[model samples]
Target: MTYDISLDKKKAILLVVGCILLVVLSFFAGLFLGAMIQQPETVTAAPNSEKPKKASAGAPAVLAKKLPAKPKVRLPVKPKVKLPAKPRVKLPVIAKKPAPTTPVATKVTSAAAPAPALPAAPKAKPEPYPYSIRLASFNQFKFVLTGLSQYRQKGMSPYFAKVNLGEKGVWWRLFTGYYPSRKAAQAAVTEHNLKGVQVIKTAYANLAGIFSSKNELNDIFKRLDSQGYSPYIIKDAENHLRLFTGAFITKKGVQDQNQDLKADGIDSKVVER
Candidate 1:
């Protein structure tokens, strides 16, 4: 055995070469083992980083966005609460006037209030046309005044009228009145047919028909005119128409005319005017 492990130059050189090759192989193996172990460490680092990225993306569910807030400030509402309108002022009303018919109603009330004082006011009036008998008209004022005074002494109410003509003359006519009417005055004239009473009352007349209608008197007037009798007309105090003879003033002349009118188929009478 000692003889077989003998050192030679060639074997010694081969053995040293093999030892170098082993050392090189060992160094490469160690380097390969370290690289495989470090690959697991890199895979572990990638899985750890992916877990953080997934966690960061899912964390956005808790968003910090703010919602719309209610308006708490109310400045415009305070101005609207203070605003109020003023009320309108009132005016006065006018009064109305009374009607015009109120005075007429008052007059009717006064008329009904008193009835006895109405009739006493009318009895104090004097007579309008008192009766008068005209005696004679004188040419002088003094003579008629003297006649009026003399007639007044005979229980006659006497007055005189002055007849005036400008620059011509002034006369006075005497009369007696204060009687009732003209009919009574004519009765006095006929009763007192003395010297200076009526100028026609003492005269005679041939009387014709006394007519109440003018048409009846017209027929007689024509008949009397054809018989040559000049007729005259007079009105009595009662306004009655009296037809007579103006030409026959004496009794003998009226008697002759009455005979002539009777013979001519006309009936008549003798009268004193």
Candidate 2:
């Protein structure tokens, strides 16, 4: 039967077509699966890239495994800070002393400057005289004054006064009253059991001559023209003109003058003034 028997060819063609279809189906399936289950993109460093940190596989636990980085030996750098400047303080200036000008001007300026005022000192009061006791008088005798030191030792300031009775004058009357008042003097006299405490006014005298004639007194006075003796004359109660050389409290003064008059052949005596 020569009937058109193309079965082998048809089977070959079918096999070829089946193989082509399987290839196309596998390509489309792979494309669709790749698109559905896509993986995230990973960035990798180059081998020679200089990074301060080591590469990590995106894992937190990998930090300890990272190689220790090169220790950057940083040098110490000084910080630039501005400081406030110190303020200047003014000092007091002392003026120098100037040279002196004219001597008159120097004197004037010195005089112009007032002296330092001193505090007033308390004024001292005058001392009252010491109380005294009047002892008896030795009318016919001279007071030797040898007992004066003894009286002073006994707390007594002893002294003498003369009572003039013209030619009959009493002897030096011993006393000690430099006392303030008569009462004080009386008290001192009573204390010492002293009697006859008569107050005596201060007196002094000396004599060069006692002449009956004023002419004889003048002659003696004119002869005593020495610079030492001051001579003067007065008529006494006896109507006798007595010439005095000087007045003195002490008898020794008059006695000495009497000795000097004796040297000059002129006699003298002491009297109260």
Candidate 3:
């Protein structure tokens, strides 16, 4: 019986040995898987540094206990975002200029340069006889004759011309040889004590205009002096002649002059030439 029990025990021992090898291989594979997991965890923990660590069976448990739990944390609520108000800006003011004052004022000056002078005036021609007058009407022949005599005494000559006006005989009487003006003739007539004395004006062709030349006037007076009359002629400032008295033509006129003559007075006569 002992000899037959030894072969059966050897077959039982091979079965136990195969089971033990399988158990050891499974333990080493479990250890390798743990080490692989530990290597990734170590690499993740030291992202900035390069190092290695050995894996252990109890490492997962210890690491899990040391890790912090996710706390009930409320993310900082975004504070009420309020934009600040914009600052107020002020604009600058520009002052305006005043307008010009006067009507004549401008950019140009008043005393820039003087203008050219104007030309002078021409001289005027002088009058031959500066003064003259006219008489409107006259009456009384005797007064006219007597006025002629008085004019001759006052350094004047008488001219008498007659006109027939119906029943009245109109006498045009004139006096010449005024040194200044016929205003002297009118003044002489006003001062006289006689009646019906009227001043008559002489024309340019009468006294002043007719006797313009000096030699011609001198020749006329020489001829009158040769005919027994003291005739003299003189010129005034305006080159006008003053003819003086001469002898009487009629005898009755001479006697009247002699009768009317004063002590210092001379005879008035009309001498024919």
By TM-score, who's the top model here? 1
In model 2, how large is the Cα lDDT of residue 98?
95
- Could you tell me how far off, in angstroms, the CA of residue 38 lies in candidate 3 after the best superposition? 99
146-252, model 1: which lDDT tens digit per residue? 78677767776554444444586755545554235556666776765535664222245566866555665788878886765545455555445566643322466
Model 3: runs farther than 4 Å from truth? 1-156, 161-185, 191-195, 207-216, 222-273
Ordered from best to worst lDDT, the candidate numbers read: 1, 2, 3
Candidate 2 per-residue C-alpha lDDT over 41-138 given as tens digits, one digit per residue, 9 for 90 to 100: 22333555676776577756543567889999999999988898888988899898898776663466655868644333224332333233455566
Note the Cα lDDT for every prediction shown.
0.60, 0.58, 0.48
Per-residue lDDT, model 2, residue 139, is 70
How does candidate 1 fare on TM-score?
Answer: 0.27
Model 1 steric clash total: 1
What is the number of backbone collisions in each predicted candidate, taken in the order shown?
Answer: 1, 3, 0
Clashing pairs in 3: none
Residue 232 miss distance in model 3 (angstroms): 9.2
Candidate 1 vs candidate 3: the TM-score winner is: 1
Flag clash pairs in model 2: 132-176, 205-247, 205-248
| lDDT value, candidate 3, whole model | 0.48
lDDT of 2 at 53: 79
Pick out the ten consecutive residues of candidate 1 with the lowest summed lDDT. 116-125
